[model samples]
Target: MKKAILYLVDEAGVIQGVQLSAELWKKAEKVVLPLLEEPESQELQREGPLKDFQTLMEYWDFTYPYSPRVRCPHCGASCEDWRTDEKHTFILNTANLGGLLVFHCTRCGTTIRHKHFKDHMSIEHTIPAKYKKS
Candidate 1:
């Protein structure tokens, strides 16, 4: 099925939204479905069937397929949409007994930090300023 992924962008133009394709969706299910079939997972589902992809995406970060391009936080450019290779740096810290996530905007040379990289994407990167304060 044709899927339109939605992206949230900053004024500088970085990716903030995610939509999955039928292929990606199926892939996600492949990973999650097996887990859901497990006795433990089935027990958890006693509350209800897991109904959304976001839950699987959040639970299966390492396996979730991500696109190569990111939005430029300074220029509002859809880096992947334009197929540009401008380097955006991602800092993942799983060392030194400290946890931090950092994203560097290549277009405007801005660095953003968050307690968690995934949180940074879901909360800071994808959210527009207009909606950030709210």
Candidate 2:
């Protein structure tokens, strides 16, 4: 019989993860998924700035549709979709009704601003306080 599950190990032979066969995964799905999902009580609270970012999009009045992409000029770190990026590179710092959105870059302590205008968008970034020359 073939191995039902493959144990992915590190160089030191410590099991780092598991790769399951389709048949075996089907059997374990019922038991494993809940363990991975967020707890009920935890889910009740706010999920973070991501929700606020989405709320601001609903109020967007820009000429072009909203784009989820964000970039940090200070550190050259970027996220295609700030909402779903697993790395959490850029964090939503502020979202307001006046068509202004601010993000704080985790990789570099930079503040990025996306200012939406009627015909175009303006991008601005401020270097971290530590990097600011006196």
Candidate 3:
């Protein structure tokens, strides 16, 4: 089953606007009200997931040598190491000890998911509907 069909993400993420289902909205109103009261900057500036990224490196089990290059599949934007990009082209979305790191491309609305394995690292992406080309 899809996990998050309750809230709309676009119009955007983290989020420019939120469209919640009536049932869920009614229940969530209590929790969501306080969150809205002390509103903060929509864009949370993170220096990158330094500690978690380091932990993933330390436990590297991939066959190839460790490299930090991250490229957006939807757009041609590539970075040698996303964590150190001065332009901030990608934001770390998720990372875990399970060897999966998800990054959101700043140049395009595509999500880059890197799954590290013992033999190699598997990479994949999900582009937002608005950016889908014919």
Candidate 4:
């Protein structure tokens, strides 16, 4: 049987998208990234799944197989779809913190943080983002 349905969850730790394997993700990267960065495609506004993919690509730095197994902690939702920048979703990029992948769970309002360790990865912390008072 297949190990797990690969998912690109949203900030809510909810399965927002599905990804079978790194190979498939790579294929998507090739098709999506160029369009977002290409000068000719500037007029095209990226929305829906494309925006989520773009955010993930930017956060992962085009790395493949970010996590062999992606499962939500709160809801235990497997990889489904990648949702981003919605009223209930937000992906915070923490590259400075050792390439941390910070996802805010809009459903439960939980912040899930994961760190990359070579071929494998693990959840490092799950906390709220520190905001500054201006």
Q: Please, what is the TM-score per model?
A: 0.26, 0.60, 0.61, 0.35
> Which residue pairs does candidate 2 place in steric collision?
none
For model 4, the local distance difference test gives 0.49
Off by over 4 Å in 4: 1-64, 67-70, 77-90, 124-134
**Of 2 and 4, which scores higher on TM-score?**
2
Once superposed on the true structure, which residue ranges of model 1 sit more than 4 Å away at CA? 1-63, 81-101, 112-134
lDDT of 4 at 114: 63
Q: Report the lDDT tens digits of candidate 1 across residue range 32-128.
A: 6786543221111111112222343345454334343445454464455222332323322111112233344433434444332433333145433
How far residue 42's Cα lies from its native spot in candidate 2, in Å, is: 18
Candidate 2: stretches off by over 4 Å: 1-51
lDDT of 2 by residue, 1-134 (tens): 28989999999999989999999999999999886543212221134565666777777777898888999888788889887888777777777767778887766668899998888889999987678889
Better of 1 and 3 by TM-score: 3
Point out where model 3 deviates above 4 Å: 1-48
Candidate 4 weakest lDDT stretch, 10 residues = 37-46
Q: What Cα-based lDDT does every candidate model obtain? A: 0.40, 0.77, 0.75, 0.49
- Comparing 2 and 3 on lDDT, the stronger one: 2
- Model 2: weakest 10-residue lDDT segment is 38-47
Q: lDDT per residue, candidate 3, 1-134, as tens digits?
A: 33423544554365445566667678888998887544222344364565677787788777888667999888788899876788777778777778888888776758899998887888999998887786
The lDDT ranking, best first, is 2, 3, 4, 1
**Candidate 4: tens digits of C-alpha lDDT, residues 23-119:** 6666677787776543221122224434454455566653446542334475443343334222323334333324455554443435566666555
